[model samples]
Target: MNSSATPVAVDMGSSSVRVTAGSFDGARLTLSEVARFPNEARTVAGRLVWPLHELVERTRAVLSAVADEGMSSVAVDSWGVDHVLVDASGHAVAHPASYRDARTRGIPDELARRGLTAQGLWSRTGIQPDPINTSHQLVATLRQLAPAERDDVARVLMVPDYVAHRLGAEPGWSRAICSTSGLAEPGGGRWADDLLRELAIPTEWFGDIAPERQVAGHFAGSSDVPVIRAGSHDTACAVHALPSAPGPRVFLSSGSWSLLGVETDRPLLDDAVRAAGFSNEVRTEGGIRLLRNLTGLWILQECVRQWTREGVPTTWAGLTRDAVNAPGATALLDPDDPVFQTPGDMPARVRDAVRRNGGRVPESPGEVARVVLDSLAVSYAGTVRQLANLTGANPSCVVAVGGGTRNDLLNQLTADACGLPVAAGAAEATSVGSLLAQLETLGEIGPNDRSAIVDASFDVRLYEPRASALAGLAPPNLERLS
Candidate 1:
């Protein structure tokens, strides 16, 4: 295989697994999508868990196809926090629990009983004490295990690392994603040993944390190809893929979850940031991602899924089109409402939330979709403003990447609510960022010129706020309406 042939980038999201082969010549870069497979969680005994073996099979099939293309390197990235517990021989003790599982529903109260307050956690890890965090999930799992079963576990690997291990790569953890565990020291990538000691989680269970772009191993069949450590966390890779030059611009990686934040040279550990629900996850490029994880398109996705199950199928484009034309500000719900976190009866929940908040109950699918889009935009707008306020960043525009970029209505509403322009595109941002990391690690893309090259390689859609939408914000009930 030629050393210059582009690497294969595998991005495994909660909803889908996408594989792309990129060819980056000095002048231009061409990315071709090779394979895409739905990556759904299985309902095992009423608990949502990732089907690791099936996912591994699907990934191998994709990699096998790319092996014949003379590819010399592969980079894999996925959603953070969720991990698999394996024995010394690398067999999974149990299926990996999806973050949406309710096992950790009472973790916050449990931690509180142990005198581990949210302030203590936020100050130590710079992560919000969310039940979805790996630490909480690990504790929840341990509580259900027999003493013998717990002793059999030798190692834990995050989703992306586990996939790489199945592909013959050295099993390890990435600091960028480990920060999402709510166990890493703030501003530093080191695992928080004190907190781990408090929780009685042996540090050895987690392998050594490696920096991004480190070579893991080679594909099983393709011995010559290297498996590069991309930012294991999908959002970290997406942030790296931003086409803009390094500046104080708000980066919104919207997908199943809308992670809105600012990139700063340092982590924001102030009381205000913590109170505002901001997290400081480690960035791949030695920075900090001061962001908040908002309940993104998941609520709307669940509604669509439920509707399809009931024989009323619709696509995202159709939903967005209907939402764009629906009357604005008629209904609204906070995207972070806990009731909408789990799957099932999403439309009913949305209606319930709206009515509880003193808004009209949406009766139609389009109206429900509008409520979701408008609420999401308002969430984005509020987060953007908070980012500027807390970090003293004066961002001129918001840069949105990932699948949510296709939602033009959401983007425009965000602009209207935040009073800032939005530049959105690069739907396959995590893959692009993973590819860039692989290329940069291989010395193909110079550090000094990387941002410029990415900017030239991709396109951006500009959205400016509409006055009508902004005017609707004056009403207390329709603050997110614009």
Candidate 2:
């Protein structure tokens, strides 16, 4: 233990919750992990429940562990859109809904019938409007439930705020996290009242939350902890993990969904981008994470899950290795195809997507794996080019971060397709980011310090793009096989 004081930042995700303790040392940050909890949404009696009480128990347990470790302060952040409904007594009124549910589909269309444009929504929220957004979900809730239950609902706060309330602290919610809720404004830190009213969502459901730069509130966890808003958005925390490249760069946080995009100072709401499945997620410092959400390795993961269920003994590592050795790619699926969105028969859907696009379907698990990886690389290249055009920042390098960067095949394919150097690895990018954002929140790190610390702690690899692949990046397919 460093004899020096420390602060803890908590990052809560759909899958897990993490507590990292540290303070920046100007040039670098010293971080240590305290605890992690297995988290997932469960459906009981046909309602998706977050197990908020259990999560709080875990949070206190982790903080108790951190206290035992002698760490100083603590903070919290979680995935966006889902929120806890608080009753007048300040107790949780209802369990938060997961974004993965199918209920939000028709609300946007229904609202559009009432003259609400998604483009207008983009400009207001500076966020890509998705049906799974909180506003849309709320509308769906109204349509499905009794008016009395809806009337009984009082205040609503996102996940982190909900946790803060349990800690007996004045919930200082983070607007940065709120920005991704598809309900909050993208550029402005305030909630978009007009959009809320237009969607017929109760404007009073939300409360004032500060931007990421400001310290939200204090959490008295063993110590008087200042709970900073550390880029309350999970993706924002993950992006913070990417090394600060010298020039412009596109980062692919590949996992269940490939978050592909470049960071921008302004929102890109042009109809073409919107039509192309692009949306703006907020960055930590109020920038727009101009991105397109592609169904990424989740298909590969599900394929493996099914294969394992069938006793084929496939794993992520094994699949990646086999995919690298597999002969070639026969076809590609536009990553945003809705067929691959939900959980069900993934392989069949993959084959169908390829077949419909006039592409060859895979015969074996290896081919299907190759098909998915190669298509991701191709998609990454296309997104990189679009990001450069959209931001006018010619990124000479594409930074592939997150767990998927370990795949040698995908990295090299991305390098070749984009004709740019691919810097891959730092598999713990999201964790580091979540931690660093906390350190920054505690007044220990600044923007300049963030770059230096990441450069020192992370082992980053680079793969140069092939000239042959650049030639094929024309209006048509000159695609490079991963």
Best candidate according to lDDT: 1
Predicted candidate 1 versus true structure: per-residue lDDT over 278-390, tens digit per residue: 99987777689989999899998999999999899788888888887889877668878788898899999999888888777888888899988888877787777777778
Clashing pairs in 1: none
Error of 2 at 276 (Å): 3.8
Listed in order, each prediction's TM-score against the native is 0.96, 0.89
List lDDT for all candidates, in order. Answer: 0.84, 0.71
Q: Residue 242's C-alpha lDDT in candidate 1?
A: 87
Q: For candidate 1, give the lDDT of residue 66.
A: 78
**Whole-model alpha-carbon lDDT for candidate 1:** 0.84
